[model samples]
Target: MWEETSAVDKYGASPTGESFEPGRQRQVCTRYKRKGKRHRRQTGGATRTVMALDSLPSRVVLLYDEWLKLADPRTEDWPLMASPIAQTLIVIAYIYFVTTLGPRLMENRKPFDLKNTMVVYNFSIVGFSIYMIYEYLMSGWANGYSYGCDLVDYSSNPLAVRMAWTCWLYYFSKFIEMLDTIFFVLRKKTSQVTFLHVFHHSIMPFTWWFGVKFSAGGMGTFHAMLNCCVHVLMYSYYAVCAMGPAYQKYLWWKKYMTTIQLVQFVMVTVHIGQFIFMKDCPYKFPVLLYIVGLYGLIFLVLFLNFWYHAYTKGKRLPKVAQKSKALQNGNGVHHSNGVAKEATNGIFYGTTNKVANGFHHGNGIHNKEK
Candidate 1:
């Protein structure tokens, strides 16, 4: 019994050696119970944190669904308007090609001779632009559209339906225009693929998706109509250019194209700005009014800067003068006529001339000719 007590005092075990005294056992159980409770709390906290993390994607999906609910039910079923994913992927692929893969692939390759292809493409766009213009006019712009306070005709009226259809066509045209950059890349006119160029091409379709989905006609259609008109002129210039050097004389109004573009943005800005002063302009989605106004103002500033640099700053030299300067600089050796010895070589002359005239101008736009 004394040995047993001694063991209990030394090792905290009872006489059976398998258990502790009741008081000590209670303390040990309490300690383990406390640890178990703490572990359970920690596990519960971790589970909740995991649950919150798992809910993030669900939350995003819910928000997207809510946003979709705001879209025009009529247009929600239209091609490319059903989801933003298609246009988004298209823009991404476009950027990746023009900026990255396309340039790298062309690094060691001769520029493709695409003059014939370009002519066809440009004129095709001209024809398409004309079609869109007529549609815009017939549907609204000419069909009793009050340019001052036109609101989106969200009805099943033949005219309204026609306008919506026209707007979708316009949106699709933006994708078609992206081929412009692809042509530039193919022809090795990478210098023509400026930030303004890519941005204009990519943003148009993406934004127009929303436009067609929400406000397909009315005040918004004005810019689309005006843009189509400008494109008719712009693509016509490009088509003429693709016809060869004999047609160079017809491009005298090259600088004026930029002027025209500037005018377009100005008119767009002014037209959209009228909403700010009008009272009770029941224009559904006043948000779009602000967006169009801002878009116009931003492009106006960008094109203005382009004009200032390309024309006002005297960066664009006359063709003859440019050719003459290029010839003199070609080989650093000028003949008595002030032409480089290499000027006799058609290849050298053409290359140097192109280099001399490759100035940035036009619709974020056309080729180096601008």
Candidate 2:
């Protein structure tokens, strides 16, 4: 990578031996020697001659110095970087609208057919999640990261800067994912916005701001990477679901999706648990790690409960539907194939039993008795 310099002046150089500008060459060498001393004095430990030439590392070094001076001023003046309080308020507003006000507004109205919209949104999220995973890995984790006791790297190293960018992108994605609940509202799929779902979506962005602002590179980042991996699968599932009802036949993996999610949260918990056992890691931000760990535990418990109700407990009919079924017999019966003995229990519970009718009902599915 050295830049070659000729001793001869291009304007005039005698053949072979004697140089016409020997005095000028001597002066140039002296100036270079003085500059070298200054560079050494200023650089101190940053005497990484090779490292200084790399594009990303050089840019990171420049930006980090700039960042130090503007950290406080730029933060106050900036939009998203203002303060944690502002972010918290935004989250609170989001929660109040989606769970409370938005649902109420949609109460009397028919559900909007947001199939196309949901398809686009979910797939977009899947793409973003995958990109984040790549950045997190290539940026730092795939490098010298210990994944056990690694601390936040504040240096302007290329890997560190890339990691910071990924963390910021991850934080921003949380904001975008707020649309998940909003879509549920628009489509009147309010039931999908469970307590766990609401809490997860609402809390992520607010908490992640702290992560991006401070510890963007370190042991704390493993969960975010894992979460991104899970989201690639998770959002892909939702995208397929949004394609239409015809796709339901291909959705036999729905049960396994929940299982995968449970596994994701468990991994998060275990990864964060390393902090507790490590004898000497100078990770200054244990608060975030604790929060991340507790958050994982909370969701694990919630997902477990959801799995129990969804799969293990079997389906239970509602009181109103049960009473109505008990009182009725052949009232709404339509006998084309045979007989449609029962009314539908929403879309989830299709036909249950069939006598002459082409249907069978076990758990709230419409059925015909022989």
Give the alpha-carbon lDDT of every model: 0.73, 0.65
List candidate 2 stretches off by more than 4 Å: 1-79, 308-370
Best by lDDT: 1
84 in model 2: Cα distance from truth in Å? Answer: 2.5
Local accuracy of candidate 1 as per-residue lDDT tens digits, 180-282: 7888788786766777678778888877898888888888789889988988887887787777767777666654656787899999999999899999788
Q: Which runs of model 1 end up more than 4 angstroms from their true locations?
A: 1-17, 309-328, 331-362
Per-residue lDDT tens digits for candidate 2, residues 1-370, read 0111344456535345556566776565566667777776778646565465666777986787675553323123434765577778879988998889999999999987776777788789889988998898898788788778878877777777778778878888878877766776877766545564567677778778777776777888888899888777766766766665566565565446556767888888988997898888888778889999998887677567545544565644434445565454644322222212222222121222221211211111111121
Give the TM-score comparing model 2 with the true structure, all chains together.
0.63
Q: Considering only N, C-alpha and C atoms within 3 Å, which residue pairs clash in candidate 2? A: 338-356, 338-357, 352-360, 352-361, 352-365, 352-366, 353-360, 353-361, 353-367, 353-368
- Count of steric clashes across candidates, in order: 0, 10
